[model samples]
Target chain A: TAGITQAPTSQILAAGRSMTLRCTQDMRHNAMYWYRQDLGLGLRLIHYSNTAGTTGKGEVPDGYSVSRANTDDFPLTLASAVPSQTSVYFCASSVLLAGEQFFGPGTRLTVL
Target chain B: SQQGEEDPQALSIQEGENATMNCSYKTSINNLQWYRQNSGRGLVHLILIRSNEREKHSGRLRVTLDTSKKSSSLLITASRAADTASYFCATDQYSGGGADGLTFGKGTHLIIQP
Candidate 1:
């Protein structure tokens, strides 16, 4: 069912350029999240959405924004990229807020 | 900033042996989940243990949660080469912080040698 899918498996962008990482889940999960994994630091939450229309900031949400316009898609946008934003980005979703999550393959972003 | 921290950043063992990984969190959690990530792949959920629960099992995976210790362990018995991957522990917290996303540890890279 393609539990979850992320676009642009990897991207190399120049600092100050903008990009959007797309996430879509077919499981019809009620909650979706965006996280970035850095070496030695693990995965840090950047943003989350409890439902299609409601969103909230997470542990590391600066320089990024998200929009959940519908039930299937939760897209994260980098208005202006920075070198510190380079990391492996993951998109996850769960049917229940506190249940196990399904993750996408991930997008490797390198901002230079 | 991560709530959970996994021990033994890397582990190597022979196939058919047992491998165990530990995770400790700084805050109370509603549930703790174990996930495995193969090289260049997305994470796959292995099991989940709720706070009130002491242990859980699925296939060859056994997970034990000690809420009092704020720690959890994942044990994989009779490990196989296919079991070589990075194991991560994630926690969904207890506080009512809206949209409190799951916090993950740095992960334990387990290698099963043949």
Candidate 2:
């Protein structure tokens, strides 16, 4: 199995530009999450989906939007990228709600 | 914020030394988990300790939880250079919180100097 895969391993985006970060999991996990990691700040939840077709706001969901249309993919969209949004993004999946989460390699986005 | 907080923002130790990282959270939790992230890599699950349990171990890794104190500690014994990485402690809140997502801490950067 591929586990979880995130697209665009690295990117440089200009301010106010829009982009989508793709995440896919072959584990058929019922839950998927998007997190951004900043230096010394830890990982902050951007958004999460319990299952396909539904999404929920996380700790820092202001500049991001997520949609879970199917079980295999959940993508995060940045409508207007800001320099503050420059961080490493990670996608994770878990079969059991309370089980260990499997993470993707991560996408490093630099918003200039 | 219900984010977990870890002590000793950074640590540097010689090989074979034991490295301990402590995490403290505000709310009640059903389980606490430890994860390690090597530089430029995704996180790997290390161990999980349930609230009802006080201590758990796996190989050279030992974890302890004190619900009353709302804190947990992860100890890596006989550390090696390969063990140099950032360690984070996450908690699955006792409130059921609806989504079952873990709130992570700032993480402790551990370096095992050879």
TM-scores, one per candidate: 0.97, 0.96
| Model 1: per-residue Cα lDDT at residue A37 | 88
Instruction: Evaluate residue B14 in candidate 2 and report its C-alpha lDDT on the 0 to 100 scale.
Output: 100
TM-score of 2: 0.96
Q: Residue B54 of model 1: what lDDT?
A: 100
Model 2, range B6-97, lDDT digits (tens) per residue?
A: 98899999999999999999987788899999999999999999889999999999999999998899999999999999999988643335
- TM-score of candidate 1 on Cα atoms, chains taken together: 0.97
The root-mean-square deviation over C-alpha atoms between each candidate and the true structure, in angstroms, is: 1.1, 1.3
Candidate number of the best TM-score: 1
**Candidate 1 chain A lDDT trough over 10 residues, lowest sum:** A94-103
lDDT of each residue in B1-114, candidate 1, tens digit only: 788999889999999999999999988788899999998888889998988999999999999999999999999999999999999999986455653768889999999999
Q: Give the DockQ (2 decimals) of all models.
A: 0.77, 0.74
Model 1 misplaced regions, further than 4 Å? none
What CAPRI-style quality would you assign to candidate 1?
Answer: medium
lDDT, model 2, position A88: 100
> First chain TM-score in every candidate?
0.98, 0.98
The lowest-lDDT stretch of 10 consecutive residues in candidate 2 chain B is B91-100
